[model samples]
Target: MAYQQQQHYQTQQPMPTMGMQVGGGNRNAAGKPLDSNGKREWSHGLCGCFEECGTCCYACWCPCIVHGKNKQRINHLAAKGSPDPDGGACCSGSCWGHCLLTSFLGAGWILQCINRGETRGRYGIEGGGCGDCCTSLCCHSCDLVQVSREIELEEKSFGQRY
Candidate 1:
């Protein structure tokens, strides 16, 4: 009796690559194309607070409120489908949290740094975590103003009034 040899075949799945393009070119979180270096620059500089006097004043006088609004706007932009029911309320829980942290622990810079990092990630801005923390710690109000301006500009580009 002759026995036939049997062979088992295995299929290899392709591994997912980093920065994979879905349609055409590499796009950031806001659906904008990346530069040749694969990163985007901030719409406004950190020291450009005076560019929007109202925003600067708002950020200076009521930073927590501005933080809340900026957080809400970033969340809305990231979600990109339904509008936030809170409508980016300035007195949201985040505002209270920031106020409490700043008033009590003097640690609001931690939260601000996190939000700054998030904003950078969402817009694909070029920066490092260290820089974000430093900016939030040293230039807190400026960072808030910059992030707010960036979000507002993004919203305007998308034809949405902030």
Candidate 2:
């Protein structure tokens, strides 16, 4: 039965595939997962122990998505001023402070939805609001804020089409 228990434990304890879990088995009532260590590293909706840490920040990965090339350049730039970028007295244990770029591309989903003169949270929110729903579903039911229907279009080059 020891072998069976070990195998069961292995399957029950999934590891991080994209980001870190921060803490152990402190799952929510809905079993949404927890960050017992409170490292706040955010996950890719995976429920695993704190040990299987993920490098990418699922919640605040703006820098990764927007500045993909810049990130590679930063990493490729042969070592830096310090043995580790975030090691000074002013620095925390993590290099998050050293990233010289913004993370998420969107300011806020709610703001974008409002600015677009729309309702419903169709676009996924990055931080406070906004997300990736193509339909204008996020703005209609909102009562706290209202946006006018008139909107101006900004023209851009071919590269900005996407």
Candidate 3:
């Protein structure tokens, strides 16, 4: 019963990681560890980079998920108006939810590991659930803005070369 309540509190409470701090208090930028909706994925931030790629949607800062050639991982779905699948990037004409990291990391090593791309997708919209139904699993994730920026630079370089 206590465990159940702990979980309930966890769910309802604002969960934050080590480095992610928000307002003047001990909260995150949004006053909560998780996003407003408590759901985060590839594009994590004020918005998610999925179904579209403006800000957080389709954007990623987590490490690269290695996929074999011609590998079909996600059962890609087309939302409204997206684009083509260049690197099998969660294509719904846009970015599908990517395995992303939320803002809170437990240990210092965890933060280092994230910087080094050792662990990926431990937070945010986890596709893996409690083995039953998908109960909107929301957790503190990393701000992959740095990672997203890096991708943009690479793309720009690639374009210049091509």
Best by TM-score: 1
- Evaluate model 3: give its TM-score: 0.23
lDDT tens digits by residue: candidate 3, 1-162: 455444444346667663453221111112224556564333233233242343233223322232110012111111211111454443322122122222333222222233323112322332332311111122112233323332332233323321
Per-residue lDDT tens digits for candidate 2, residues 1-162, read 455544444346666532332222111112223245332212222222122222223213432221222222222221331111221122222223223322343323433233232211111112223332221133221211111100000001111221
TM-score (all chains, Cα) for each model: 0.75, 0.14, 0.23
The worst-scoring run of ten residues by lDDT in candidate 1 lies at 21-30
The global Cα lDDT (0 to 1) of model 3 is: 0.27
Q: What is the full ranking by lDDT, best candidate first?
A: 1, 3, 2
Counting clashing residue pairs in each candidate, in order, gives 0, 26, 23
Backbone collision tally, model 1: 0
RMSD of each: 5.7, 19.3, 18.8
Alpha-carbon deviation at 157 in model 1, angstroms: 1.8
Off by over 4 Å in 2: 1-52, 59-83, 87-162
Clashing residue pairs found in predicted model 1: none
